[model samples]
Each structure stands twice: as structure tokens, then as C-alpha cells.
Target: MGAVDRYLQEQHIDRYAFLPFSACRILQPHKLRNCGEVKTVLLLLTPYYDGDAADRNLSLYAVPRDYHLFFRELFAGLREAFALDHPGASFHAFADSSPIDEVDAAAKAGLGLFGDNRMLIEERYGPFVFIGEVLTDADIPCESGEVRECEHCGRCACSHEVCLSSLTQKKGELSGEEKAALRNHPLVWGCDDCLLACPHAKNVEKTPIPFFKTDKQYRLTHEMLENMDEEAFSSRAYSWRKRETVLRNLSLHGE
Candidate 1:
């Protein structure tokens, strides 16, 4: 274990990989270069709340509080704390809000394999883990080894055109054809068709994080949104786009 591994272990993070910052620059050049003297990049995978059959209506990712905020809190003061142990180095942390292509970073770091649906698939957490990173000026060890390639088994059953995750977030009212498709679908917020179709998604270990294990919901209902105050709405990932977007989706779903 190196400095990066020690830091992650102390923070209770079990899944991570370290890569040269240069590799992260290649995948998302426009987004990752501005963090200042980033020499090594650490890719961290944190699991989110993944509900079982009762919560099938919601996407696995949204089952927890906004992961962007979750990671920011988890890595709070990490750079300064790390600097205390090693001089002349700076660290910065970012989650999904950053420009880095997290899935690509994780894939390249050998943290997970890329599924046909473009989701990074980990053996333990499947595609439900959130990817975060610590960018550092330190020369952290990077013997993460090769990227694990997916078998490309052509097993993903849902096509993007009809993917409910995209369809529910469509800007305006659903088209006549789209409305016909939603008639039988139970979700108004997001879909997990691809995940449910994945062979690897089955029999994965449940997330061990306390925050993810409790206090989660499987669906975003109009009633739930209507009842929330400003603070409650503001804190959630689902509400970042605002209430109207969800209302629009709910209406389209005939809720």
C-alpha cells in the first residue's frame, strides 16, 4: 500500500486505483487540466443505496443523497491532511460535478470493467458505485495494472432510444410514440433496465457504507416533491434540476 492506499483505507474506502494524471487528461482534456499541478490521480469507487424489488422504480444511483455532496464531505480537508504527512504536495478532490469522465477514469485505472451500457461494472458493487477522485501533485505509486475489458456479450436488452432514464428527462411533453411506450412503464423518474439486464449486476454485495445502507428512497413521487421545503429539495440530486422538471415527468407518466 502507498500513500494513496493508506489515505483511502483510513477514510474507509476499499475500492480505488491510482493512475498518472496524464491518462486522465487524455480522456477528458477539456475538463481535468485546471486543478493545478496534478501529477497523480486517484480513482475511488463508493457504493450508493441500491434498493431491491420494492424500489425498482428508481435508478440505483439516485437512491442515495446527491453523491457529489457525499464525496465532498468524505474527502473534506483531505489535501491539507495529506500534505501534513508529505511536504510539497497539494491535493484536490472532485466527484461527478467535475469535468473528468469518471467511468473512463475508473475503467482505465483497473477499478472496474465497462459494460455495454457505458457503466463501469465492479465485481462487488456492479454498476452502482459512484466514482470520485483525488488529484494530487505528489508522485503517488501507480501500479494499478491493466484495464479490465468487458466481454461485449451483447446482453444489454434495452436500447438508448427507449431507455426510460433518458425519456423521462426529455425537455418537453412526450411524443405520441413516446407516450405509448410509457403506458406500461412504472417509473416516472428514471429506469434501471440496463442494470436489471446485466448478468454481473446479480449477486453483488450490498453497500457497506452506513449512509448508503439507510435513509434511502426507491422512487421520487410527485407527492414527495410537493411536500418538501426549500432546504429538503435543494439537498437532493433529483431536485438539482428543480421541481418543474420532475412535475413534467410525472404528468407525462400520468401520475
Candidate 2:
């Protein structure tokens, strides 16, 4: 387990913690069925916020390429290396589609605190990070840290029901109230209002990860989307919602 920690640090993983499988809040047990009696979970945090964009029409998180693809490639190499070191152990990596409750597990591992906006707020990265995990059958010894609460600054008081980010991703026709809320919304894909309002999020350091800083698309115009093929679009984080959803949001923004 100590060697594993050193290796992960060398790989430039921002933060990591080892958690027992029993301590994790499993949401999708079937996803881990083939892992063969998971014993320990390695939680990792990868910060993705490069910087704020002045001409941004998309969420800060959506400006870069999809993190899901990055995690897939990363975990693949890690699994191969760990297999060489641990002869009979099994390791499986998961990100957004993880079986366990990622935020809860991360908090319990002493990685960060729960923000009022329902996001994991790491002290250094605020909420601008992606959580990933590696499940292994090895009984790695580790300490389960206490979960702490973030400062209730009331900045993220808005509920999910009225969240602009959630509203922008809705399919089909939006109601008059929804349309009105989005009329002057700067983001066509997601919102960053809560993050911007939070004091902990202020003056945060930009991501050191090179992947997030390269090939960024801060603003997405209709012409750009019109010319993009499926492959090009799929590379973006906002592409999961497809072109229709974004286009609809843009239209509502009076683009």
C-alpha cells in the first residue's frame, strides 16, 4: 500500500486515499460483481479547472475535453502496472459511472468536505475536480478518516430544482419560466454561479494537469456545433447531452 501511494504520487494524481470496501456507500453493486470480493478502494481526485474564461458560454468544467475518456486511458495503464507488482490481485477503475457513492466515499476518506451545493469541496480545488476510484481485492491497510463539513457561507443556497445547469440539460420543450431564466444565461451548456459565489472557490489555483489546459473550447457558437462531427463533439464533456440539448439552450439564450 505504501508503494502504491508513492507510485500514484509520481503519476501526478492530485490526492488519494485508501478506504475499506465496507465503508463505501455502494449504489450499484452489480457493477463490481466481476471484481471478485473487493477489499479496498483507492479514491483519487483530479482537479480540472484551468482558469476562468471571459468569453465563456459553457460551464468551466465543460470547456475542456471529456474527463471520462481521460480516466479510461489513465486507469488502463495503472491496472497493467499494478498487475505486474501484485501477482494474484484484481483491480478495476471507475469514474462517473462508479458503483459506489463517490462524493460520500471521498469525504469519508478525509479528502474533502461536503459543500452546501451538494458537491465535494476539496480545500485546494474547491468543487472543480473529478473523482475516480480503483477497487482491488487486496486487503490494503489504511485509516478511515473523519468526514467534515464545509463552511456554510450560504453562497450555494440555490436548490437543484431551480439550477440553471440542470435546466439547460432538460430535453424537449422548456416551460415559459425555464425559458425566462435562461434568456440571458451566459452558459449554453451548464452554469457556474454557485462556484463563483463560494468564498472557498475564490482565487483557487489553476489545474496543473496538461490535458485540461490544451485544446480548450471556452465558447461554443452555433457555427462551431454545426460543423462538428459526432467524433469531434463526443470529445467534449457537454457532448453527452447531444447537440439538440445545447442548441436548444443556445436558442433560449437568444443566440
lDDT of each: 0.73, 0.84
Tens digits of lDDT, candidate 1, 69-184: 66777787556556765587777777876656777778888888978888899988887788888787888777545557678877776765677777766666667888766656
Off by over 4 Å in 2: 1-7, 159-161
Model 2, span 128-232: residue lDDT tens: 989999999988888677778888989777644587988888888899988888886778988888877888887777787777888898998887888999999
C-alpha lDDT of residue 34 in model 2: 86
User: TM-score, each model?
Assistant: 0.87, 0.92
Best by lDDT: 2
| Pairs in steric clash, model 1 | none
For every model shown, the clashing-pair count is 0, 0
Q: lDDT for model 1, on a 0 to 1 scale?
A: 0.73
What lDDT is reached at residue 235 by model 1? 66
